[model samples]
Target: MSVLQRLLFARPAAAYPTHVPLTGLQQGALTVLSALGALASPRRADLVAAVGETSAGPALAALRRRMTLDPRGADILAERPRVTDALLRRAAALPPDTFGGAYAAFMGTRGFSADERPPVRFVADAELAYIVTRAREVHDFWHVLFGCHTNVQGEVALKAVEFLQTGLPMTALAVVAGELRLPAEQRAELNRTYLPWALQAGAQAADLMCIPYEKHLEDNLDELRRRYRIIIAPATAGAAARAGSPTPPLGAAPPGFEGLGPGVEGGTAAQLHETSGRLGPV
Candidate 1:
């Protein structure tokens, strides 16, 4: 094939199945266009995915390498699991105190779907592509674990955490763009309250990508947080308290959660526990 033709229509290679390799120029062009689109309309998930995939080669490689060094991550690399609707269904069936239950509530209350995450296309290595896909898929799970809301301030703070965890250029860019768009008061709040918490929580938590989340679906959500050293933002905790669903005290896992599991009257207890502060507001 001619160079131009190859650049325009590169076939998938055996080593990078499902990948559509892009030339450096093409990748750079896509990055710029997608970044602009994403910045202009932050809700355009497709544009955000394009920017992430186009700019993620080096970061993905590094993440993949890191994953291979940990036993659970190595298992993930070998299995190449994809978060699917079936998994979400299973999560939805769990009790509210469980990790999967909280995740399902997080998605349900927000009207978000796991299928909405875009696929990885531009990275030329199969493992790297899988890593990118994994990162995208587990994003909401991160939100659940971190107690971040979908609001601008919360998203920006979570992006900082993501940047710390994955070192992805797209995440860094998102943080910068999010900060630029915030009002002065909110920006100050982010800088004062959320940013410091993100820095501490992101730096202290275990490598999230290595966790076998599917295996831990039945685990207690508070236990999972304790195991992962997750630090919930104070605002999130306060919100939970205001909603009359107080969280377990830091470093202590309380009993029963005030009848907050499944099968509660009207199912309001579960919903309140999940949305008020545990899984974060939609």
Candidate 2:
């Protein structure tokens, strides 16, 4: 492996005495924060700023309560194993267009494709990488569940859900950066269209964090969306692109793009949390 790969896959230099790591409940809390954080797109970070509103602290709590309390979005959460190379392989082998043709249509409309990041062939953490890998792989379904598309706003929403679900630092970064890209109006819309739903969905939905994402290919998208109470916006992105107008704020790309598609280049989640990517399990 290259030096960077070695480092990414290597164990932490030191054990974290206080890290406790996120237990299921703690992760659930972060899921709420991540969800709300994501919704404040173009200002996802601003959403993170909104995280501490004591009166609104219940966001995380709300997420936890929903996951523990409801039965809807939890089935997939059960089949998940900790992140592993084998799991990555399995996810990759499951299907090609499982992310849905809608995702592909979304990308084509934007004139971008995967090729942004080096392939994530190896899961960095033998122990925890499977979790991360699985988390990364299933991310698109999260988009499908929440009616998210590739826009600054959708990324924040998705990242927020990731935070609520996985508590990953990367998701936190996406949520924060996404907010910075938004205008005042978009932020307000997020609070209504995405955040409330995420709070409930992140909390009450089945444990997506633990599910085997590859197994859900035969499942129904509309049914899944209905189960999760997700909304689907019109594909306005294609229109904006055709107009030859200035790029619209956010919603510029398909949902879950960290610049990882076929021919797109340069951007990485590390470089821009408003990143881009293809709809693959990779």
TM-score of each: 0.79, 0.46
Give lDDT tens digits, candidate 2, residues 223-256.
5545544433323323335556322222334433
Q: Model 1: per-residue lDDT, tens digit, 177-217? A: 76676667777877888788889989999998898888888
Model 2 regions lying over 4 Å from their true place: 1-125, 226-282
Model 2 scores worst on lDDT over the 10 consecutive residues at 259-268
Model 2's number of clashes is 62
Best by lDDT: 1
- Which ranges of candidate 1 are over 4 A from the true structure? 1-18, 40-44, 239-282
lDDT of each: 0.69, 0.42
